[model samples]
Target: MNVSPPPPVGRCLDMCPMRECKEREQQGRLFRFETLVGEGNWARGRCKMRSLPLADPSKTVKEYSRPAAGKKLSSPCDLRPPSVLLKTVNYLLMEVWDHVNERDLASLAEAYIFVFDRLRAVRQDLTVQRIQGRLGAFVLEGSLGFLLCAPYLVRDLPSDSYDEVLHAKQVRDCFADLMECYGMDPKCPREAEFQALLLLYDLGNMDTINRALKLPRGVGDSPQVQIALAVNRAYLEGNWVRLFRLVHQLDCLQACSFYRHLPNARDNALRVLTHAYSSRNCRFPLDLLVVLLAIDTTGMASEMCRRRGLAVISGEKQSVVFFKASFKDSGPECAGREYILIETKRGDFTWAEIMMGENEGEFMRPKTN
Candidate 1:
């Protein structure tokens, strides 16, 4: 009969720290490779639980705004016991996955928010810690969901459309919940990814990112870490080309949604760059601006500037000038001059207040591109 060699003596025996404990160590002449058990023989004792599966993260945040099957989500987890809320959430998440895959962000938000609202609506003096844990996870899911939905939020919608404003508020509410729950005591597996996404969203806020990631300034060398850092480096150094490339090429890193938001992101960045120029000298080379905006023509740049109330002065050599702030000139053309200063708030809302609901006041706003 063929015999397989005894799985080579466990290499961990020498490195095992448990050998020092007399009570915990195996009762043998010399600490054997595999004789210890229980609290004493930690090194020799095999892992009790099965190995976890690999992290194949799915659904871009925007993708989760929709629910699966277009069918109303019926949280099957709402069984007799209140503890079954966890199961209900898991079921809703499954529905969330189905919706995101369908590219229906609206339905996705509704289902998750529905579940979250129900949990919050509960009036009992809840003693179960499991419910709290589920709430945290749900909040995380909603927060990430809005981060991806941010691009859509940035676009201008009809003010009269109640549906548009409602969606925006829903996105804001989720974002608020996310911020409130972000720095809690218990860490979740997806927290790292959420932090990475937040870094990508607010490229201008390096200090916040540094504190959040706990990394030395300008020192993200680990390839195993999320790719948001890579994008972060590019954006900070004004490497727009590389930043765009990284956005499109990181599906495996769970940033495929970044690619979807690329156009809006570029628009937002260009708008910021234009906004940064002093009112006195707003002129910039049209060709250079085109290259920086990653657009094909100066006409497009001029059109965008006009929409934002910036005067695009054309020069003989295809040079264009952008006015960062609208000048208060009394003329038929400059009638709406002051309103031009009402730049988008870019999703301004207090997280503490969001958690407080109406008690937080009515100044809630959604995040912009």
Candidate 2:
């Protein structure tokens, strides 16, 4: 009978990290190498073997399976969750993914846990630039998650980084452009609709202020302008109580309804708030007004107050009260040329504007926009 040549020692063993590889190594026969140096003692110098291709060291089989290995991971937005758990988790994950994808570090950092939990293995293919580009498109598509998270993500990026600079400008400029597009006019068909939105921007009482600044091109007497005036009036009047209350309501509503199925929720809110804080209102009240002013305007309470030459002292439990003995002029043309200069109150004060008298059973008549 013809004898077959012995099979090469197992070269594939080199790539195996299993216990069998160790056992083979201990026996000094770890790999499948085709050539046999000596005859097998039991076989009587007639080795039974088959020739097999040697293992390519450069292309060895890998054992460990990483989640992000090989294929690209799909976006959280890609899969729509069916169950509540899946929905919540996916929504939460989408929040993070959208933030990171939108290049919004500030927002991602705010809800960091939500983002960090969804990440599995690191992919070599995904880069920061790619993420930012995807985010830019997402923003253009009016993704509220991106809009909500954009501020935070952009905040987290390095101040000196080019992306940071561009994104920061983009958020403000985009908001301004959108406001201009809508044209803040109380006569807007949606004026009544945007009332709550005006409050969100602290512009609820803006019509009163427009009456004060009677420019030929009147402050667009819209709900948005009213929100701006409300913020300014709150700041001017040094009414922290009302300011915080309004902001808390606005923030709560925005946070809750940001992506709710409710129709026009996000757009309405964004429209109102954007117009309110983007104006050249009195610097004093703007400083003390927190919430959107802090989120949308210049900065935090103390810095805004300081910049306006107002005294900001941290009161009990981190409450900030701004007080300054500076006089400012405010009055409508109906009040004649004798503009009233109200004296600044030093103490933490709260005063309500009295309900003005109405004409012919119109005490609470909702003024038509």
The digit string of per-residue lDDT tens for model 1 on 159-248 reads 332244454454444444454554443444445545555565555476745665674223333332347777777777766657766654
Q: What would the per-residue lDDT of candidate 2 be over residues 22-105, giving only the tens digit for each residue?
A: 343344442222112211332232223523222323222112223455742233322211222222323333332432433454
The TM-score obtained by model 1 is: 0.38
> What TM-score, over all chains together, does every model reach?
0.38, 0.26
lDDT of 2 at 264: 29
How well does candidate 2 match the true structure, expressed as C-alpha RMSD? 23.8
What is the clash tally of candidate 2? 27
Question: Which candidate has the highest lDDT of all?
Answer: 1
lDDT of 2: 0.30
